[model samples]
Target: MIIFVYDNSFEGLLTAIYEAYYTDIKPRAIVSDEYYEPNLIDNRIYIESDITKSNKVYEAIKKKISQDALRHVYHVFLSELKEAPTVIYKYLLIAFRMGYQVDFLLTNQHVLNMHKISKKVSREKHRMLGLTRFQLIKEDFYYAPIEPDYHIIGLLAPHFANRMADQHWMIHDVKRGAAAVYDKKEWFLTEVDMKLQASVGAEEELYQELWKTYFKSISISERRNPKLQKNFMPTRYWKFLTEKKQS
Candidate 1:
């Protein structure tokens, strides 16, 4: 069995698939280099991020699956879930096997996992949309920070761009060390050092104070259930979530 390994980027994954089809060895699995563990007899192919080959795979997927499906795939990839790459590989394999008919991915296990991941990622994306109140910095650029479990800044830029078209905004995904910036017309993502001390929103303290008050006010002394709340909002997520912090 063959193993195709690539960097974690979406383009890198595509290039691996491109190589998989062109290679003589049949693949038992296609996964990221981070997940790669060499075997005694298995064939291993290390695929690099090649723009030309990646573009070819990209175009093929675009042609086969609608733009909407591709977008959904992007969100699922950004989920950073352990099985993300495998799920994408399965979807791509089915797409190749079934041709255009693979577009009906809802029934397929691989595609369904992608859908489930997308929905989870999207719910977090939307939650951050309202929960992430931006801070006004100098130069009229609105800056906000989010440490989402997934890389969802690009997935969310269009909404803010449409809502605040006249203004410039940047949403930094602290966990991924990337930020999405939108200047009136176009949008793009960039990598940045999260280590640098970022200035806080002038109103951040006030909102935080208010957020605490609200959290306190919402409780019913007779009905409080810490166990249920923990089950719903795991403690690990509290660090980045504004509303999830302690009073």
Candidate 2:
């Protein structure tokens, strides 16, 4: 068995695929360095990320496949599943062989799995858009913290950019140690350890309390169903919601 190890970046994964195709050496597995475990029976091949090779592969795919197929490639990459790299490899192999119609090939297990994972990622992105709550901090910047199940800050950036076009805001992914910042015009993503002092502004605290009170006032306790509430807003996200957080 042959295993290919990459730097665990989307570009690196594409570069590995390029190398595999050019060398005519099909790998049994394609994994990132952090996830790789040494095995005596399997020969390991480490692939260095090359922008030229990655771009070549990307352009080739764009020309050979439909633009919608290209979007699926990016969405699947953002899915962040452990098996994503290998799954993308297999899915693309079938896509390139079958052309644009590969998407409708639901009977193919690889195609079906990729579609499912991408849909899960899309749902998480949609939930974050609706559930995200911003709090005004001392420096006049709005900060919203989230712990999403997937790395979806990039997916969430454009929506907030349009919604908060006049404000400087950040949507931080606390679990991933990364954030997407929008400064009234453009947006960028960064990775930094946040040393947030629990020094929330007094006005912010007042608004939070008001919002909590409003939430309480709107609730009809007699008709409340916890299971239905959970279905709409999962319990895992309660930690960051202003209304759900313990006072």
TM-scores for all candidates: the values are 0.73, 0.85
- Per-residue lDDT tens digits of candidate 1, residues 112-169? 8877887898888777676666766545666677776777777777778889889777
Per-residue lDDT of candidate 2, residues 78-126 (tens digit): 7777788888888888888888899999998999988888888888889
Model 1 residue 85 distance off true place after TM-score fit, in angstroms: 2.1
> What lDDT does model 2 reach?
0.78
Candidate 1 Cα outliers beyond 4 Å, as residue runs:
39-41, 103-107, 196-247
Model 2 stretches with alpha carbons more than 4 Å out: 195-228
The model with the greatest TM-score is 2
Q: What's the residue-level lDDT of 122 in candidate 2?
A: 85
Report the CA-based lDDT of candidate 1 relative to the real structure: 0.68
